[model samples]
Target chain A: MSNKVLPLLMMPEGKEGKVSRINADRGLLRRLIEMGFTENVSVKIIRSVKGSLIVGVNGCRYILSKDIAMKIMVTFW
Target chain B: MTNNSIRVALAGNPNVGKTTIFNALTGAKQHVGNWPGVTVEKKTGSKKYNGYEIQFVDLPGTYSLTAYSIDEVIARDYIVEEKPDVVVHIVDATNLERNLYLTTQLMELGARIVIALNMSDLAENRGDKIDTKKMEKFLEIPVVKTVATKGIGIDQLLDTVIKEAKKGPHHEHMIGYGDDIEEKINQMENILEGDITLSKKYPSRWLSVKLLEGDDEALKKIEGSPVLDQVKNILSTINKEEYEAVMADKRYEAIDVIVPQVASRHDEKMTASDMIDRVFTHKYFGIPIFFALMWAAFELTFTFSVPFMDILDSAFAWLAGALADNVKPDWFGSLLGDGIVGGVGFVLVFIPPIFILFLLLAILEDSGYLARAAFIMDRLMTKIGLHGRSFVPMLMGFGCNVPAIMATRTIEDKNDRLTTILVNPFMSCGARLPVYVLFAGAFFGRQAGTVIFSIYVLGIVAAILTAKLLRSTLLKGDPAPFIMELPPYRVPTAKAATIHMWQRGSMYLKKAGTVILLGAIMIWTLATFPWGVEYGSEDSYAGKLGKVLEPLVAPLGFDWRIAVALLFGFVAKEIVIGALGVLYGLGEDAEEANISDSVEADPKIFALNSLGLMVFTLLYMPCIATVGIIKKETGSWKWMLFAIAYGIILAWTAAFLIFQVGSGLGYD
Candidate 1:
């Protein structure tokens, strides 16, 4: 399945939680690794203001532009 | 004396949370300003701890110490000349190997070094362990783990810094290289050591390595000194071109050794970020995803802002009526109700839409996706001969043109900077948001969202076409190659993101009080007239001015009243709405009428007219402040005037065509 439609963060209350493993192709995998995304690292959904999800990776948070986030596949672990 | 305060400098790569850590340590004591004679920001702060006044200077973030850019030059100069009490080198723990490359360079600078292993929480969570003790032992500096965001390990980090500051420079520590390169470095260092001045400040071995790397800044620094000629003679003997290749090889060799010992990783399974990036960065899907997100942003801007805008409009109208009822004289009431309140109120109604627009933009920026958008759009940007780096500033233009033009500092090439600055005004700025919202809301109903979205797209297209034309003719040059480090994907902090949004939104509010206020008052005076006759009447002063210019804009179907609105728009575009409000004798309260209904009832206010106005706004001469900034940045009044004249001519021609063709299609 295409990873773009994956629901990566399951924020029932929209609080911080551990990030789930992603299922996608090799090219995406390599790019993510380069961007400091790896398995077992906790990701926090800080806020979903204006339909864009602001997630914190490691300790530093980056607002993920909405367009890029729609493609990452995941389910709340 | 122990009473003497020590100066410490914090340096790191961009997006490493260095600023957060700086704010955490210093709190309210910090002062922020630009570096001397340069636009790069400088931050300095001090805190008293354990009887020692620890002064901290936050140098601009840079990837390396090589003077390839202004920030790097500033960082290197501060360290080498000022000789800080201790240099705290902050590195991202998650990307230890890449971060340490800078660490090796810092050590070579011969300063008292302390490595802050920031973001330890993430490192621990990822199942990757960094043995701080081993790292300290191998690198020969104190290693302190810190999560700057949560204020973790900060005290310990400060304590280590204090201890290191007392010890002064670490002369014994040197990053080792292999025999071949080491032999070359030793020969050069020895040759330069005898020149007394060369050995006084800089480390000989570090100077030798930099000389070999063909760093021009370093070459210039050591130039004119007798020792430089000797170094040059040695370089010529060794073949200068090959010297750089050999030094690069040496850097890699050192990296090869330092990375494995100080860093270890657990091979993790595929993470969600990786999986998501795959399809998002895909050749076919990425562009479509970008369009979809932008579409959502447009939809939200129009749909969500309506209710708030309506409430604000009503509140202002009610206030205007109450003032009109209580005021004594007729002219006084007109000035209060029609002039001040009407003009300012017309512009004030757009606050809701501007706020919503900023919120959406902040969300996008805070999220790490904006960079990826730039990454995806790079090819298209290149095809039009504009650097992808131009995207960030242009994106910023959507917030405000002033800062967007200021952001041109990041674009290194002069020609690229000029082109980006010239075309930036075409991007639908926050000021123009109200004009579009007011017109589109009045004319299109629910379709207003799509209408606003199409206007933004139109602005972008005009900007691209203008950039291409300028490049081919006036600003001819090959666009600089696009190269940028894509930061890791993380959720942005609510505190930071909100602060960013408010800061941008507040600028608009401030402008309303200052420039827009003066503009509205002036427009009111022009529309007010000779003797007691309202200036808006066909026989008044404003009428004469508008009639004289009306023929010029007649092709776009604008009457004298519309011509007056366009005239005021040149002073500040927000006044376009206010000028229209006053001209129509719509007391401050009258502007609250449903715009969509008014446009529908009067077919003359066609979609074509709206489209033409949007195009004209996108292409017209920028607001007064932008013109001042253009003069300052370009340092020439000739170019500034050229920008103004060219913009107005282009705007008129484009608006004329859009209206003529669109009306031909029976859009009215």
Candidate 2:
């Protein structure tokens, strides 16, 4: 485990990280938060295809586009 | 307001089996409609529980009651406006922490809620010990463990609803935002109280919270208020976006503390669902597998419906023959035979295909593979500037465009939905297939299959380029964010899937029947008029109309008859071949084989002309029924006319290019 923060797109597949911050337009940001991407919550990259990834958070799997995955800042440990 | 009846609303995140429970409770007596002015579905039913008549409503499946999307706005508005006596919040016990987040928002809205702990069986199977007593005690809401798929605990749920309705709602579990935001919320609430009409309409505290979160609808409600300036002054100091984050964080934080106390879990382990997803959404094989499955669905839909369609075709043909033979007046017989029977028969022929297609889609949706399908195809769809949700509607355009346009409501972004709607007609709906088969089989002979396939590919290209053009020009913006929830897979139950299929499939019949039936009669009337002249002859009204447009189509090497048939294509694309048959003085409902020979025999029609006509048909405007749906869904006549105009212009340009290029190459 190490204290390194990077975009969720950069998180290696099959590893867990904590969501550090989500930078997006107001509507998308609220949606992201409602989907359980709040600060300090654990998120796992379950799979990646091309640039988009399947994120595992709060006992659910969400397929996020590359643009959205880039906006989410995750802290890997 | 009545003591003898209780109104209960069902609310939940998508894929919590909320619909399964809804179907279980409502049975076949459900009324399906759209929320006023929007396309989101609103369904209501009634059941008798404990000597009280209980009315139930199924709200759109959404994670929160925020105004970010239409579904969220509709759900929250229904709660705030209609004020159902009890809202049954269906929660997946396996993911109580996240599901409970919605529960907290429901608390804020100040509605009476009964928590149905759905899928509790799955949670127990995965080695989670859930203490329902503690959960009920903490949330102050009754908890009923329901396995919606198996129809378990439904009576208990209904019984709890009645009891809760009788006792009245308690919003006792209000979340405490930390001091700074709480003080601001209080200040806003005090200012909001100054507006009597507005405060009486919605909860002041809820309004304050929404205003502080930068909700557009909430901000609109405060317009022209005496305290508007004061509220704006308070809002001006803080970034509402940051406050939104903190408020949502507080809601989840409250759930976090309660979840730990109410449910303890063993370390998370890989489940069968994860294993299946690993294979289904795998990068290398995922796209190929999706195409394979989509091919299978299309094959099953078309092939299985053929026998039933043949039966309807023969049945209608016999009925028309009998009607003509038995009737006394000659003209009256034609009306019954050609107008009434033929008109209704056209609509019925599409029923089998529509029903079967909807059934397969519903089963896929219920099995949770639709989201995975969208996931694998997202990258390709993005290249065209459309959201992944747009793919379902685009693929459905092959079956028919009327229902396909209706399916665009799934897209949350206005620009994306409108763009998808505008381009859908070019996908070459099933109604247009007979036209392609007629043209290709007449001109290309042994290469007919290749030519027909090329026309379909051309349609795909047209749809792609049209969507790209619209995004870059009129509806310019990025595609909607492709954030989707992938629920754990379940073997869809037959009862639930059938109910789902019937609900969606039946709506298509109702919508298409009106325009097709009326348009059929109109085309029949046009061809039948000017009684002294030969029916549909050059001296007849139909021929006069064709003559009126012949010059417009002359550059494409088409005469009056071809122009008239093209004119009739707007009624429904399938009628184009039949219309041509009549223009050639054959049976109005002539068989495709007979029509193919006649079209080829006409000396004016050449291979190049036939090829160009096929391209024109492929790119033309949607059927009249689809045009109506476009207006209804987009809620404007301007967009509908835009869709019609752009389609014709593009069709003309493409056909002109093909004609000029093919001629210069000296193939024709």
Question: Which digits, one per residue and each the tens of the lDDT, describe model 2 over residues B1-668?
Answer: 38688888999998898989998998988998878887666899988767888889999998888876788888988888888899999999888877888999888888999999999998898888899999999888889999999999999998888878887645444789999998998999888888898888788888888998888899987888898999999999999988887888788888889988999954435677888999998888888887667556655665666567667756765665566456768666665665556555544655776677668877887898877877877777788788666766876776678767877876778899998888888877766766665566567866665576577668867887888888888889888676888889999999998997787667546644665556556666776887866555677787789889988777776778788878878877766655554444324454432323446778888899788899888887877888999988898999999888988888888777777888789966
The 10-residue segment with the lowest total lDDT in model 1 chain B? B591-600
For candidate 2, list the clashing residue pairs, or say none. A1-A77
Best by lDDT: 2
Candidate 2, DockQ to 2 decimals? 0.69
lDDT of 1 by residue, B553-578 (tens): 89988778778888888777787777
Backbone clashes counted, model 2? 1
TM-score of 2: 0.85
The whole-model C-alpha lDDT of candidate 1 against the native structure comes to 0.72
TM-score of each: 0.76, 0.85
Judging by DockQ against the true structure, name the best candidate.
2
DockQ of each: 0.03, 0.69
